[model samples]
Target chain A: MKARQQKRREGRDSENALIFGDSVRKCKTLGVAKRAQEEMVGFMLVILLVAIIFLIFLGLASMRSKSNVRESAEVSQFLDALMELTTDCRITSFSGSVNPYKTVEELIRDYDRDLTCENGEKARDVLTRTIQEAIETSWVFSPESLYQGYTFEVDQTTGSGASSTQERIVELTWQGNAFSCTHAIGDTKSVFSASSTIKARLILCLSRSE
Target chain B: MAFVLVFTMIFFGIVAVIYTSVSLSNLREQVAELRERQALERARQLTGVPEFAFTPISCSSCIDFDKALALKQVRTYQDFWNIKFLRLEVVYPTPIDKDKECSLSVLPPNCGYVDIIPSPSGNIKTKTAFVDLVFWDKNKGAYVKVLGRVHISAFDVER
Candidate 1:
């Protein structure tokens, strides 16, 4: 009679709360629930990891883009200013009298417009001075500065009637660090009438400041 | 529930602070950079002014100041460049070093400054250049070392 009464109590307990009871089906259900919860946590962690990595990469790309824009603006303005400068070099071939002051742009524009001096030697001094000044004023690549190095080149593509093209480059004032390297290029083209066009390219490389 | 709420608030607060700091720093850097560019542009444009200009239509390095026409030209520049304050000081003849804030208002035009506009007050953006100036000074009777210094002050930034 006592054993029969104990069995009835056990049945009552299992019916009331199957989740915490010693019922066979209920135990299996609890095991599955626990495993599902673990998997859900793992998935959530993976999602979080991916989101963090994506955000970091996106931020890095944005910084790089902003840096490039700044460098591009600097280079473009610098080149424009440099080209507008007047040189002591004379371009008196076209006009009757000797006009002592002619800018780089003027010289390039009138390169093929019946110049008495076919060789670019007359304007070499002006080109050299302009390039030297540009280099001197430019940022030097270092741990402190955002700029690494720069190369300013002017290629007299069509105007050079000589044997070859007239290509000139400014002396490099800076060298980049090993880790971070960047380059920004700004171009200027001058076309006079229909004869010849002068193309000039300015490149600025930047480094991530430490 | 209260604990969870407090923890979330703290996390978000930290994130907000961090985000704001980064944004503010970037903004400050950009503003500083813009100020520099503004000064550079103004200086370049000064080269284009015929009164302060030489041979080339626009030459940044060669600035020749004409005493007769400088004041009028400077006023035109004040309008063109939206300049608040413009000061051009020249030191003619190295040995003499005849340097002083020349009052263009004074008669006989003894002052060094064109004095088109009065000096601007408050925050200003300034750029100086050691450029070549071809000035004919009757007193000196020669083209000496006339250094051109241009100081430009833009409007005050409200923020």
Candidate 2:
């Protein structure tokens, strides 16, 4: 009976050791899985941060491009308007005197009287109104913007062999503002005048019926 | 620990030397490029002029022509075009008396010449040996045909 009791005690001790070993292995596995999960979370957070930074930079670049486009368009429109006015001035009849206007305001008034849009009367009215508004909003009479008190004398007049005549001359001063600047100090002026002549004439065409 | 510290120091020293070398080389390249650009700009400034250099054949022909037309020629052209105007004075060279009566084409073209004439109306289509002012009428923007066969020519000479 003593020998049988000793065998039973030995068997119980061995089983307890096996169970302890299994418990240690399970703990090690759980620790390794926790470490792997932590590293994966770290990598995901880094990727997300980089993505957000890239998006912010792209948005800023897009906004900058848009602003540049707007500025360019404004400059182009202003230049176009000035050119149109110059062309029209080349066509108007300067009757009373070569020096029609002493100030920019006078020139603008004359320009307003002469220039009409190609569209119908309503469209022409809208354009004239817009130009008038631009004149009002901007300092069209600033000394730096224009050369004041310049002389315009008749250089030459030619009569066609026919009944009418044409006149041409160089004006020392031009009234339109050629340069537009975004900054107050950086504005420039266009001092050059058109090389082409302005002609006015009255013609009576003979009708076949007459 | 001591060996570990020494190794780390050596590694960082290598990285620092490499970075400094790269930065210095990049800065030198930028400086060289800027100097080259400045030299080119100065050269262009000196070569550009109004009289002989401003022509269609010049490498910078377009820019020179635009400036001449926009600044000098336009003003003069406008003055000539004004109605109620009568006289125009253009500078002409003194007549060169060559020994031989050369054909019109054989003589070196007038080095520079000017013609002064009474201004005529641009409306009538008559051929007269006179310079006339052309203007846009309220009805027609075209200059009436007064001066016949107008041509412009220019040449570029090396500075």
Best model number under TM-score: 1
Clashing pairs in 1: B102-B111, B102-B112, B103-B111
- Can you write out model 2's per-residue Cα lDDT over B117-142, one digit (the tens) per residue? 22344632211111111222235333
Candidate 2 regions exceeding 4 Å error are: A67-210, B1-159
TM-score of each: 0.53, 0.31
On residues A93-121, what C-alpha lDDT tens digit does candidate 1 reach at each position?
55632334555566656644434333455
- Evaluate model 1: give its TM-score: 0.53
State residue A92's C-alpha deviation in candidate 2, in Å. 9.1
Judged by lDDT, which candidate is best?
Answer: 1
Model 2: lDDT to the true structure: 0.32
Q: TM-score (chain A) of candidate 2?
A: 0.39
